[model samples]
Target: MAEHTPEDKAARAAILERGCSTPIKTATGVWVRCGSRIKSRCESCAELYRGDWAAIARSGVFDGPVDQYRFYLLTLTAPSFGRVHRVPREGGQQGRCGCGVTHTTKDAALRGMPLNRATYDYAGQVAWNRDAGVLWDRTRRRLRDRWESVEYFIVREWQDRGVLHVHAIVRIARGEAPAAIELRDAARTAVAVSKVDGSVVEWGAQAQCDAFRANGDGAKTIWYISKALNYVLKDVATDADDVPVAVWRHQVALGDAARRMRCGVDCVPQDCSSLVHQRYGSRSQVVSASRRTKYRSGWSFTGLTRTVQRRLRREWWESQQAEAGADTSAVSPAPLEDLAARSRRELVARGWAAP
Candidate 1:
């Protein structure tokens, strides 16, 4: 680690006082991130947050030796405004859009671009994004009322047509697991009405609620949700410099619309400026409040809080180190390349290296 200059130290101190982060410059000519959780702003912190979220979900599911929980992987999607470019299932398969081009994995332009940008519902898209949290809250409360004790981790994702959707991992007590169909029905009912402006917000006909019985280690479900989070984080692009030309144009349009749209009288005069600032400029993007806090109205938790989770994680790491004591014969040095790669990953995750 490079020694910080007086000015750097002062800036860091000020950031700490404000409960924020200050970027640091490294010797490798890369700017160390401030660990922002918004993927469009900081990929490194987004990855770290995803890993931590996965671990938290896993711990909630597998807290006991024997599998004793019931899990539901729920997907809630918004209604489509228009068709968009979709990659074919296989190499030789036909494309789904009018573009008639089978986009490959490397074709970033087709990922989130609309078939007709001018006809896309930019206002509805931004409104949905702003109201997504509210919808999730309603659905969560409905689930909790039925299951009694439930914990969930939800992620919001952007679709190929530039709309927002949700993916959630919901856990309930073992014997209290409701039928998948019933859960789906409840979720649908909860989302049929919008809490934002009393308008009907449909979750589309493609909503899914998959139930998984926790047997053995219960790692598969955890890994699946974690992978979904990874995808969501990786797909976010806010600036023209960070994405392909087509995708950049779409994002710029969305940003502009988000800055201008206003829904109703109670709504913020600006395009949810408070929500945008809270999401992009503060630690609220990653750090959630505990159930005991005033900000816990939305997603209340009955399992481990962040502080307890961190303590348990530290204890587990220490125990692993103790178990590996003085085992030079059993341990082998990692490859040089692997070590370098891991160092880079850690530095990036900890905001000491650029993404």
Candidate 2:
């Protein structure tokens, strides 16, 4: 770190407050020369930064295939505008009525009637998209209440592919559950656990709607979760360089070329690159493209082995069963039934049809 000159301090305040197009000094006194875009930096600094980002993205964790015991897809979304939409009138007769009313059957009315008021706020939507990532992070932490024991949950990252969303795989410890009913209970409990202040919006221009889904099928679930997380990594950088404001540093060494490359026993020093080239001609071009692309693959977690992946799977399995038993034993069976009913109602209100 370096000390900032007085001019740097003034520029920093202006850049931060007024979005000035100049270099700004951070509080720690490091000068952040704001480029037109992240790519437009001082030549030396830009190359170093891009190379760093490229390295990380080329070898990031969330990109590769992972072994999971269970898989699930969770949907987290922002609420809609409160504007009214035309709906079919229910229980109407004479085919028409005064007040410009068009009559229809009960079923038609139910089908056509707007479920709720609609609203429109472009600014709110933009703001919500900006804050969606933060909100998801907070919401995930709030989910701890669903478990008697603290379960290990690691967020892969929010993804934006064909759709923009967040994905995470939670590893539950094993204990009691071995059936779908118990697993369903855990999933419901996980969904029910929510943050009170997760409004994500402070005013009329606020966005709402948050949800989650849990898969407890052991390794398959983890694989799916990893895949979901991979969706995000496929198109972005995963190092401090891409996120210059970051307060931490993450780096990896290549180690022995053979070991790092996972080369075969037959590979020799002089023929390694040539051997690899022979084995992957056009494929090398694809790898090169990935190297230049914004997406990253070198993060620590991405380097996990099947052994580690399986261990996590087993841990989550045990945790889930243990949680199920504890929950079942802690309360009366009648209360559980009541809980189930209420949960069903909430689900229905949220758009799921009743059984």
Candidate 3:
């Protein structure tokens, strides 16, 4: 590691004070952001994460030609392994649960608990979660075959019952757009057989989709999809402190099922160290956006990704360091070439070279 100037030292200290709550100091006394995505774990980092994704979400809707595209907000859910108590959210419609008890907002903890724990298909639920990625791939392909000029950004979030729920914003060319219900029906009916376990996976009977125009009601739709990002940051097994006994048992059963489930075709549950088992059999990313291709402008037109964001921060820091050390004789550390940040600067300053 190279030496940093007094100005560079001051900048690092300021960052340490304002960034990650528990940042780790490198051996060279350099502090790096903890890179945590959980709000509870690190509010500053997580908020930065949320803001970036929110910008990406808005970019797909607002950055494009607003009048030329149609957007739809869609939610797809997992099939129920067994009936669970359906306690309404605060101020939601009060209804009698299957167990003959009317659960109110006060009974929020019991929302996803099984009425008959003995019969709840914890194994089936975990298996479905593990295979959710495959199912979505098939669904998206199906949607593309059905619709023209399809593009999307999807988020996978946890339901109170520890199952994954998908929220997506789908975009299509204006002239080729279909009704929201048609898209929902096609997505809900799409199914795939898991290659890992050869079991069929499908969405639940319930699905919701609503179409909005970028020049019209698209902002509301973007906000709705972005709101689901809050749950995306949270761990599936989080918030276990002081929970009801039933809720704890429910989570424990799901965890056990996930642990015992096979993550790969040849996976041995007892010895496999895959984190999928720890995450309730969920191996998919919390959020996914389409990538830019030669033919299609997917997700963000600027091609913003977490890597891009990190590189931006590093570039800014390197610029500060270079400026501070201008009067000093010490050579500044070389920036990462693969990041292209330093290369772009070198090109602008000295022109492209074969070497």
Give the top-scoring candidate (TM-score): 3
Candidate 3: which stretches are off by over 4 Å?
A: 1-15, 24-31, 218-222, 237-242, 326-355
| Model 2 TM | 0.27
Answer with 2 or 3, whichever has the higher lDDT: 3
2 versus 3: better TM-score goes to: 3
Q: lDDT of model 3 at residue 249?
A: 88
lDDT of 3 by residue, 1-355 (tens): 2335775565345556666564433343444455456777778867777777877777777876768878888899999889899989867999999999998888887888888989999999999999999999999999889875888988888888999989888888878888999999999999999989899999999899988777766457656766766665776543545579888889989999999999999999998867688778888878888878888888776777766766686677668767887422221221223423433333334433211
List ranges where model 2 is wrong by over 4 Å.
1-73, 81-120, 148-164, 176-223, 233-355
- How well does candidate 2 score on lDDT at residue 145? 47
lDDT of each: 0.56, 0.31, 0.76
The most accurate candidate by lDDT is: 3
Candidate 1, residue 218: the lDDT equals 52
Candidate 1 lDDT (Cα, 0 to 1)? 0.56
- Candidate 3 global CA lDDT score: 0.76
Tell me each candidate's TM-score: 0.65, 0.27, 0.84
